[model samples]
Target: MISRRAASPKRSTPRLPHLAGSAFRSRSASPLALNVMTIITRFLSLAVLTLHCVAFAAGCTADETSTTTTLSTSSSADASESTKESRVLRHAVFFSFKESSSPEEIDAVAKAFEQLPSKIDSIVDFDWGVNNSPEGLDDGFTHCFLLSFADEAGRAEYLPHPAHKEFGDTLRPHMEDVFVIDYWGDANEVTDAKSDDETELKHAVFFKFKDDASEEDVAKVEQAFAELPNKIDSITDFEWGTNNSPEKHDDGFTHCFMVTFADEAGRETYLPHPDHEAFVELLKPVLDKARVLDFTTK
Candidate 1:
């Protein structure tokens, strides 16, 4: 819900039209009677002016009240959308299959995992793909699945949901080691899958800072990092947030930044851009360790 902080409307003094002085004076009238008549005329004119002001102010108040109501309604809608977006809980899973598991078995597990969002109503976003990065940083994990939930309650429901449990059963036999990390963040930067072969690239960066790094240094890094898109045109979408998960799988990483590019060439330009190099210079001092993962959307 939108909270209104608007001030009360101030009352304004009405500007009265000037009246001709001689019009209220009668030439043939007695002095006493003229004086009384003048007083009575002035009173009536003043009363008319006050009435006109009241009527005009009332109409203005009515119109202004209607406009405020419309603005408030629109703000409430925006607030609702923001709240929905903010509550997104990202569940990231990296799976490594056992040596004995065949490609067909792994493919079956992947298919079953992909069906979870359709089976569960709480799942807001879902994407899964095999590791296709040229960088050898993926370790042994080959498959990555990203799932989004609207809230913790949605995740709670999903944890024991029948379909999820069934998928877990399917994955249990084939999986050699599984690494799961959950964080409440904005994952809307990642796009959905398409039926066509065309796929976009996502650059995911995780940062672990030195223990002595101050909040100011981190804020500076964040501010400078946010300015990169303005300097480079290849960035399609960008979002970053601090880690908010209680899960110990984070491995001391606290910040995640995801940048989207239209193609690998776009990423190539972004990597070599002088602006990116400068930003990296600012980040290098406080950054103790970093991991980068690049993948194409499925």
Candidate 2:
């Protein structure tokens, strides 16, 4: 009786949906729906990888730009520091007022001259004082002004400046004579001498060599003068150079020697020192005119 119904048609079970070669099977999804979801997941992963690569590349570029800028800034600072350390141009000016100029007028002229440094940008250093040399070799020059510049360009700019031109106008009527000498010198020479607590006395000497003097004679004189600092204990600092001014105001002076002393006693001892006298003996024959100006720095 049970085998009798077995002849009826047999039925097969339905298969679950799954991706090709996948172990997982889903009962709720169709094959077409699973294919779409797999495609979307793969595309999202690729998109995330692309975003990470772009962010990394941008970071590298930013770092490189920052490094280059830092290097450029460092180089400029080093060059500026080196220039400040090496040397500076010196502008030494001396003035003598006319006999007709009263003290008040002379003082006004000096005040006006002093203000130019503030008004002119190229004047780096400034100092001035009245002559107090007991040696009486000033050649009627009563006032001395010392100014400094970084280089020739700075001086060039200062020379034609409106402030300097105005100052010249104020000085012309009262000025009897003007002497200017420009030279390049070590930056630390004057600064080191001035660092001391004692008051400084500057002995500035200018000489116009005789027309007949030989170059060898001039060299000997320069060497002998240079040796005075080594021989004389009273000389605090010493420097010398030939005039290189563009203004043609040296008044026939060629060589300028600057000697610094700590006090009046130091200068007094230096003036009559045996070594100085010996140098003077060597200098007199070749020297045509010597102008000496001594002042206590203010």
Best by lDDT: 2
lDDT of 1 by residue, 75-181 (tens): 99999888776557877777889999999999999999988889999998876777766656666778877788878888888988999989989999989877556
Most TM-score-accurate candidate: 2
Give the Å shift of residue 295 in candidate 2.
Answer: 0.9
TM-score of each: 0.66, 0.69
Candidate 2: residue 16 Cα off by (Å): 74
| Tens-place lDDT digits, model 2, residues 211-239 | 99999999999999998889999888888
lDDT of 2: 0.87
Hey, what RMSD does candidate 1 come out at? 17.5
